[model samples]
Target: MKVSTHQPSGLSAPGLPSPSLFSSLLFSPSLFRPYLWLAAALVASPLLFSSPALAHHFADLGQMKPTLSNGVLSGLAHPLLGPDHLLFLLALSLVALQCRWGWALGLLLVGLLGGAAGLAWPGLPGAEALVACTLVVEALVLLRRLPPVLLLPAIALHGYVLSVPVFGWSTMPVAAYGAGLLLSQGSLLLVALWLLRPIAKRLSPANLRWLALALAACGTTWAFSAWAG
Candidate 1:
């Protein structure tokens, strides 16, 4: 009896196996499109949780003084201290330059005015929720390739939300607190400028979403703590 060798029909003539379920879904560009978004979300989710890593410091900084001029200074520096805030502002500031230096200041002014409202207002219930919502939405903006316009509002909300009186409004001199916040935030901003300068163009596409997600996550937690107590 003569025996003939036969190749599996599931494979190509060259003997390569057909795209397995794992390989097809994993390697197929069309199938991966939606997953690319989900992956972006997942890889970036850690940033949402990033603030906790620095929470001890924020708490330490809380002990600093709060003043009107200092608050003004903090307001200026706030964008500097934290990576989340830095990423958010840096992403926007990059775009702001297109408008001119005066326009950049205008952007800062808009942020300032918005922050003032946040500071001056009575604490809104579920502010943490609003914060979370802000972050999530901010992330969504990047998911959709949103323009810098969205960033200004985000910066404003961040200031107001963070400014909500946590408990001690009387003991610390307001100026001292404000100054401290500025000092801390400003220092960080400078750091962000240095680090962000090099990788910005490369990271720009995903940085906004990453930062927004991070901000929203932190805001949600803060809001939760605020609402709970």
Candidate 2:
């Protein structure tokens, strides 16, 4: 009787080393995708449960003082302090990756400029409700359920609303505040978009889906909190 041996399809020979663990994880859809989603969900959980009062407090910083330094600090602190705004920018970073390079910068410019101009515009009624709605709309657009065209107007509207609190009813020059707004939001946008460019590459499409889902959850939480208030 004679015996024969067979080799596996991908292997060159019996003793060759297999692929590295990092490469295997990087390439394996079955292994890391679910874990990434779980991690994202866990990260978003705190934002969902945070106090609703914080949203009101941070969104309106003009009550402190109208000084230049204060304005700059307030501007820097608003987004970082408010989960609603921070998450909004995070979602925008991801969405902008799919848009033109100037898209994110344009939105920031429009927002800061609109806020500066919002001083003259008569206070828009139901502005709070509208701002809350923008989050939901943004999430929808990110998930590709809504047209991207709507994003510009929505962000402009948010800028206008944000100005009311930051500048209040004061007629003073907003040069400093405007500069601060630009600096704070611009820095965040640049960093977030920069970071997300690589992340979007590394993450599987399925992992990206979960990130969108997490954003939607955060938006829903903020909207509900705003509505309750």
Candidate 3:
């Protein structure tokens, strides 16, 4: 007697999906759509977080008398509130992930010094434009089109911009502002590095390139606005 070779219709082997169903699930474009959305959100987050106002001051500390409390608060808020500054710090953190701890510390020190210099010599010409340029440089670094060392000057420019509001504060308030700025920026770097380490490990190089390109576009737009305005 001849045996039937075909399996029953509409039935898969026990504990296994049908071959057609498995292939459809595997190749379905919808399967990866959520990740695409997540990436888009990540790329657009800088614009979303940034304000339309050009001023970075969250409390208008520049116009008021600078006290130790407000000084510190202003210092802490500047980096977080300013899109250009925040994006630079994030890009720096990404570079830091690949470099030695000593390098990161050195950059931080340089930034602090830059802030001090800003206070000493306030109203550096084109300071805002310089800060915007740094963002583009940082994006290039992330894309591996530039060396990580290039981030140093960019960071120093950021430090200078960060001190712009606190330029005329008294000695004590200035010190407090510096301290708060250091604390906030350092914490941001450390936290970002910690969080990105795992995610960076999992993401492909192509994904990172896309992120870097997005940052570059943002930087370019910011730079144009700064120069034009």
Candidate 4:
């Protein structure tokens, strides 16, 4: 025994012409309810993933809070937990993937050392501002398909930025910290390379402008906030 069910028009069966065929006859909004509902659901799903907010790269492990290990190793590893530092480093590593491995590694090492040295001797100003700006500038290059370069001077400058301790972690011996920092930053480089592989394939020339605009916007917002206080 077959039960007669009222399937939505185009979804119906047997002699009833396809819904679009009777478009003139069935012009009611109710006839399009299923598709409208599907579209609404599709749009809303992304918003659902949007809430509670995804954590930043280094955010989950109490990163912003100071590490209390009270030793040189801990001091070197402190930046690992700071989301700002992690994100910037990760972005640098990933974006640098466009260049040769030697250049990429050299740039990162130089930047890392420069950051360390800046802290070892605090003569320069605006280290934080420069770090923030670096991210913004790098994003523009990413959008433009430009190669990432680590000029010697810029590497020296990054060291200055990393030296800025949010509070009083500045008393640690700077030289002793370099070895530990090398290890820490190396991990960042590895992860960045791994993640960028897929992105390299998926990115397209046409989207570069929009991507740059979005990155620049993110960088500007972050830089403005860093500058504000």
Candidate 5:
């Protein structure tokens, strides 16, 4: 009798991927289609939903009474709901990912102060324009064309715009609203910092530069649309 030596032709070892399986996953165009669609949707969202009216009135506070509960709810929802505000914060987070923690915190503190100032002095002229312009300034900062220190005034303007809805509320409600804003915006920044830290470290300068240019284009378009409308 002759002994035969043979092995399975296509079997991979335990806990290891087969070459075919790995290649399919790595080289499959379908695998990346969903990601492409998602990116397109994200890029188109602001154009589809953004408007001057929606920018400041996202929380439907028009008829709501100024109460602690309403203020808190409004504050929490305002930034998340408004496309302009959301975009600004997202851009700010990306920018912050490249900066020192102290600078980021200082921006947050300055934003809080700006909110307080807004409550005291509502209806800052060209405030909407200013808010829109902040995005452009942030993009410049991201590109290293402008200093990070410039973010301070831009964030302050954002705070002022954020507080516009809470204007004329009583002290208690106003305080509650401010707390909510701090909680919401602060949490957003912190989370962005944590999540993006690794990605930021790995990003090439060219990639970051492209991101900055995209942000600048978005900001410029939004600002122009606001002015036109």
Candidate 6:
């Protein structure tokens, strides 16, 4: 019997890439194609619109009746009004995409409900810093530089921070508001996750890294503004 030695084209003679080569391929920008556009958009949005600069202070909205309309409107408006809230939501979606959606999404709901339940409790101090830190941590998690397990606690904290503004509302209003927020945020997250799932199939690891970097930049800017103000 004759022994044949052959290697596949475009592969090393060993039939596997060397560590350095693999790392290079992983970090190469060309790997991230269509999705890079999204990172660019995230970077550009704040510059294009001035609305995000305004801090959302839902807590100060004065008294509201326990009506369904008010609850839904408040729920819809809160996430839209606060850039911080939006940032946190974006981070949550990203984590859900990276990890198991069922687990991540479930924890997100639990956190939100827990937060709403604690509405009567005093608001957390240093909320701005906490939010900024959460964004930063989430970006790191997305980059694969942090453990996925930490995400649960971070997301839970985010829920608390997000709910703080509307905590003092009456029971019916708070319940209704929580429902609205869940609907709005859940819809936004589902859409984003669905869109990204397809793109992820074609994306290189580098693309995810770039996306994380973009998120980090946004988080940094948000943190600075929050701390400054």
Q: Per-residue lDDT tens digits of candidate 4, residues 1-229?
A: 9998976644446875443443333233576767765785685344223311122212124454433343245435655654445555665664566666566667657766676675567656545555556656767666644445533455456555555542234344443444455667777677566655555555566655655564455556555655665
Report the candidate with higher TM-score, 1 versus 5.
5
Predicted candidate 3 versus true structure: per-residue lDDT over 1-229, tens digit per residue: 9988996664456876444453343335786756767876886675744432365555464465788998788778777878787777787777777777457757877888888888788888777777777877887887778898887777887777777777777899888888888888888888676656655655578877887887777777777777777
lDDT of each: 0.50, 0.68, 0.73, 0.53, 0.74, 0.66
Off by over 4 Å in 3: 1-53, 59-63
Prediction 3 global C-alpha lDDT = 0.73
Error of 6 at 44 (Å): 3.3
lDDT of 1 at 51: 53
- Model 1 — TM-score against the truth? 0.47
Model 5 lowest lDDT segment of ten: 18-27
Error of 1 at 133 (Å): 2.6
Higher TM-score: candidate 2 or 5? 5
Candidates ranked by lDDT, best first? 5, 3, 2, 6, 4, 1
lDDT assessment of candidate 1: 0.50
TM-score: model 3 vs. ground truth: 0.77
Pick by lDDT: 3 or 5, better one: 5
Q: Positional deviation of 6 in candidate 3, in angstroms?
A: 45
Which residues of candidate 6, in runs, are more than 4 Å off?
1-43, 47-55, 58-66
How many pairs collide in each candidate, listed in order?
A: 17, 0, 0, 2, 0, 0
Among the numbered candidates, top TM-score falls to 5
Worst 10 residues of 3 by lDDT: 18-27
User: Which segments of model 5 are wrong by more than 4 Å?
Assistant: 1-30, 37-44, 47-49
The pairs that clash in candidate 6 are none
- Candidate 6 per-residue lDDT, tens place, 134-168, comes to 76788888777888777666666656766665655
Cα deviation at 76, candidate 2, in Å, is 1.4
Of 1 and 4, the candidate ranking higher by lDDT:
4
Clashing pairs in 3: none
Tens-place lDDT per residue, model 5, 52-120, is 446575445468888899888887877777766677777777777777765676677798888888878
Model 2, position 222, has a per-residue lDDT of 63
